[model samples]
Target: NSVSEYTKLQKEISSKRQSLYTLVESGSGNLTKTAIDKINAIRAEMSALEIKKDKAYKRLKIAKDAYADKIRSIKREELGQFDGRFVPELAIPAGTRYLANIILECKSYFGGPIEMNVWRGVAAYNCGLGRTKEWNGLPYIRETVLYTRDILYNLTRMLELKYAYSTGDSDLIAKTKRKMGV
Candidate 1:
């Protein structure tokens, strides 16, 4: 597939670019006339290769985009189970706090009442309503409010972590870690 081929070509292009840079730096010295000519020849070849690679990459992107659109259309038509308003069930394999945080992050983009399948909302409501008054003597009882906030924050970071990994964003990863106190 052109998608996979493009990925390979991109790697080749990156390597070639680095090689050209190294060759230029090495040729910066005041060497003999013959050495300078050879360096110039190499630069010219690299320049041509760069132009060729760029064209190939543009074509590759167009091809990949077309393929993805086709796939999405097919999926949308086949999955007629929902009115396109179904929220996928998310499990908090990690914890309720982490799940709540992720839900908060998702709500920012979708912008509405984010209905979580988890019982974190109920737990938070109970804590706020003093339903857990009988357990006041417990050490964690005083931290009920703080724990709820942490749950919301951790869930947000977890969602952002997936996005950062897909886009290769180190800055996003760092920001998410800082927010979650990771």
Candidate 2:
């Protein structure tokens, strides 16, 4: 993991610093040319390691964006209403794809799929919708709610479209009024 890699690099830097300190603390009236060269070499190594860490971080970000784009493209192509209705295909938004990835990660963390309701509820919880207690009665980290609202909003719109098409009603206003007993 990136965190572990970061920790390892940090430890290496600290060890190098300690070694340099020990060399300096020794009872030597003046530093020799060889000692100076060794110190310079350690500093260069640390600088190179820092650069490598930065590059790794950038690569991770790029990979995540690419993965999300791939997910979005796949969902856009494959997702549709299958209620024996001629529902037109719709495009999956980028935000939805990103949230879906997060939901998938969460699902993987908790083992495979259990049930549809469970999956939806967990996905909702992951996206920061309903309270964790109300969803699956599991404690979720507050920080994990970052993308929930956007994902849920986009998903709701998609569902509405699917429902509208399935029922042969293209008018959402009329559907809403009928459902509300207006």
Candidate 3:
């Protein structure tokens, strides 16, 4: 049985308190010694089980946290060195479009003949500001697009992390399982 089962059993055993009291009243020293020994043994076993449980939980949490931190650091490094170059002219600030050209530029790059979202996300991340709010108001045409793409890409990655952790994404869960050799 598991720890919980053992715990319940301990409780049930202890519920014989009335009998123990009567035994004590009758001066039964042998029964008292046996009861005390059994209780101590159960407690020791429970303590060991709890310690093992704590260690396992800590190990899993540390492994997952380290993985997440590494991914974020990679994104930050890419965003720090981005340079926007392939942005479309319509996506430029001078264009008549109501919506900022950067968003369109990002869409173009995303849906364009070349399906390189990761590379574009990396470029966007590297060329643009780390913060997404910096992309507002069509700051630098190319720069904004780069930042926008990078932010979107990172958001997707974040969602993937949540999905994997919650077991909401089977593929991600499978990948994690493979990584952990589970």
How do all models score by TM-score?
A: 0.35, 0.31, 0.23
Candidates in descending lDDT order: 2, 1, 3
Rank all candidate structures by their TM-score, best first, as comma-separated numbers: 1, 2, 3
lDDT of each: 0.54, 0.55, 0.49
* Number of backbone collisions per candidate: 6, 1, 7
Give the clashing residue pairs of candidate 1, or none. Answer: 97-151, 101-152, 101-155, 101-156, 102-155, 102-156
lDDT of 1 by residue, 19-119 (tens): 55666678747777876676677667657756766777788888766755654566544545433323123223334565466446445533557664223
Best by TM-score: 1
Q: Cα miss at 58, model 1 (Å)?
A: 2.1
Which of candidates 2 and 3 reaches a greater lDDT? 2
Positional deviation of 27 in candidate 3, in angstroms? 16
Candidate 3 on 41-140: residue-level lDDT in tens?
6566656655665565566567656654654466533643433221233234443242234345554644653333334433444434222224332223
Q: Write the per-residue lDDT of candidate 2 for residues 1-182, one digit (tens) a residue.
A: 66467556655665676566677778376988988898898878878877876776676667656655655565444544232112223223544565566466546544557433344444454534344434453423332333444555665666766676678665875775466454
Q: Tell me the lDDT of model 2 at 164.
A: 67
TM-score of 1: 0.35
